[model samples]
Target chain A: EAGVTQFPSHSVIEKGQTVTLRCDPISGHDNLYWYRRVMGKEIKFLLHFVKESKQDESGMPNNRFLAERTGGTYSTLKVQPAELEDSGVYFCASSPIDTYGYTFGSGTRLTVV
Target chain B: GIQVEQSPPDLILQEGANSTLRCNFSDSVNNLQWFHQNPWGQLINLFYIPSGTKQNGRLSATTVATERYSLLYISSSQTTDSGVYFCAVNFNKFYFGSGTKLNVKP
Candidate 1:
């Protein structure tokens, strides 16, 4: 089975620009999660989706960040007017029915200059 | 929110050596996991050991829920084992510690 897959692998954008990172989870998985890691920091959870519903989003830093799971298969995380601090690696993971283990994507390294 | 702390923030070991990493959490958790983040930033799930012991090859993990702590052991370490190991706890939400950075010099 294919593991979680993410698009762009890496992204570079200027300040105040908009960037979107995408994640395609493992097939037949019902739980999808978003996470981010800033430079020299630990990876942190951003949000979670159970199918098409947002299960949790408390980890989101601010309103500038938005996430969507269309049809509960692929997810998109959009950062508007990106700031320098927004640079980091964003990861997506998936599990089946609150499954204990998560299969993670390689991550997208976003660089906001 | 849960407070997760990992011991020996940085560890260096020669190839073929053995090491142990510890994680202490502040509260009870229903879900506790260990993950290894490779240099390329891929988060690989090592173990989802909420309690008890589990072994996979040279890696094994044990979580004592009553003590609010978990342990990860790497035996016969190799250069490929170099990375950041993270322990995360789910107390309503998932919280991760800064992680233990392991360097296995070949």
Candidate 2:
């Protein structure tokens, strides 16, 4: 089985630009999560999805950030008008229904200049 | 929100040496995991031990949920073991510790 996959391994954009990061979870996983880590900071949760429904999004930083899981298969995190503070690594993970352990993707390194 | 702290924020070891890293959380957690982040920024799940002990080859981890702490043991370490080890705990959402950065010299 393939591991969780994230696209655009690295992204560079100017402040106020829009950027979208994508994640493909392993087949048959029911839970998906998004996390972010700024430079010199611990990784922080962003949101979670259970199938097509958002289980929790309390960690979303602000209105500028949006996440979607379509058909409960893949997820996309979009940062509109990205800010310099948004520069960091974004990770996506998925877990099976019966397990608490998760499979994480190779993160997308975003640099907002 | 729970607080997670990792000890020995940085470590340097010689290949074939052994080392132990510690993680302490402030509250009870429903899930606890250890992950290794390679230099390329890939997080590899090492253990999903919420309690008890587990071993995989040269790496082992033990979590004492009642004590709100966990330990990761690396035996006969290799240069490939050089990376950042992170401990994450979940209450509702996951919270990660500041990782322990390990450098193993060959």
Candidate 3:
């Protein structure tokens, strides 16, 4: 089976610009999540989706960031008016079952200048 | 959010050496995992060990839930093992430690 795949492996945008990163989870997976690592920081959770329903979004950084899982099949994270601090690697992962080890996508490197 | 810490922030070892990386979490967790981020920044799952011990080839990991600590052991280290190792856990949310950078000289 194909693993989790993320589009636009790398993106460069000017500050205040909008960027959307997409992720397609493994077939039949119900748990999808987004995580990111800012420079000089550990990777942190962004949000989670369970079969198209957002299970939790407490980790979302701010109002400028939006995450959506349409049809519970794929996910997109949009950052509007992104700041320099938003430049980092965004990782997407999914698990076939509840509370299982996640299979992660390669990741998207975002650079906001 | 729970706190995660990895000891000996940086380590350098010669080939054929064995090393133990430690991770300490502030609270109990429902999940714990170890991952290796290569030079290219790809996170590769090393082990999914919440409790007890598991071994795969020269890589082994042990998580002591009661003590809220986990240890990842690398045996017969090679240059290919050089990278950043992160220990992450989740209670209601996921948390990752700063990570330990290991450089194995050939």
Candidate 4:
């Protein structure tokens, strides 16, 4: 089976620009999550999705960030008016309900200048 | 939210040497996993050990859920082992430690 896949391994955008990151989870996986690691910081969870519905989103940093999972398959994270602080690596992971380990993607390195 | 702490923020080892990394959490966790981020920045899952001990070749991990700690052992270290090892604990959300940066020199 293919692992979780993320698009645009690297992205460069200007402050106040909008950027969208996409993730395609493994087949038949019900649980998908988003996380990010800023420079010199530990990775932090952003949100989670179970199928088409969001399971948890308390970790979302602000209103400028939005996530959606359509048709219970793939997910997209959009950052509106991106800030310089948003420069970091964004990772997506997927796991089956019965599995303990999650398969992670290569991550998207976002650079907002 | 629970706090995760990794000891010895950095470590250096010679090829073929062995090292042990530790992770401690402030609260109990139902899920704990170890991941290695390579130089090219890929998060590779090493182990999903919430409790007990598990071994895979030269790598082994033990998680003492009751004690709220986990240990990752890397034996016969290679240059490829040079990267960041992160321990993440899952409760309502996943909490990650700052990571232990390992450098293995040949």
Question: Which tens-of-lDDT digit does each residue in A20-109 have in candidate 2?
Answer: 999999999989999998986889999999998999998899999999999999999999989999999999999987777788899999
Ranking by TM-score: 4, 2, 3, 1
* Candidate ordering by DockQ (highest first): 2, 4, 3, 1
Q: Give the clashing pairs for model 2.
A: none
Docking class of 3: medium
Over A28-103, each residue of candidate 4 has an lDDT whose tens digit, in order, gives 9999999999885899999999898999998899999999999999999999989999999999999887665788
The CA lDDT at A14 in model 4 is 96
lDDT of 4 by residue, B1-106 (tens): 8999998799999999999999999998879999999887788899999999999999999999988999999999999999999999988668999999999999
Q: Residue-wise lDDT of candidate 3 within B1-106, one digit each (tens)? A: 7999998789999999999999999998989999998887888889999999999999999999999999999999999999999999977667899999999999
User: Which runs in model 2 stand beyond 4 Å of their true positions?
Assistant: none
DockQ of each: 0.65, 0.81, 0.69, 0.76
Winner on DockQ (1 vs 3): 3
lDDT of 3 at B62: 98
DockQ of 4: 0.76
Q: Which ranges of candidate 4 are over 4 A from the true structure?
A: none
Q: After best superposition, candidate 1 residue A83: deviation in angstroms?
A: 1.0
Score chain A of model 1 by TM-score against the reference chain A.
0.98
Q: What is the lDDT of residue B80 in candidate 1?
A: 99
lDDT of 1: 0.91
Best by lDDT: 2
Positional deviation of A83 in candidate 2, in angstroms? 1.4
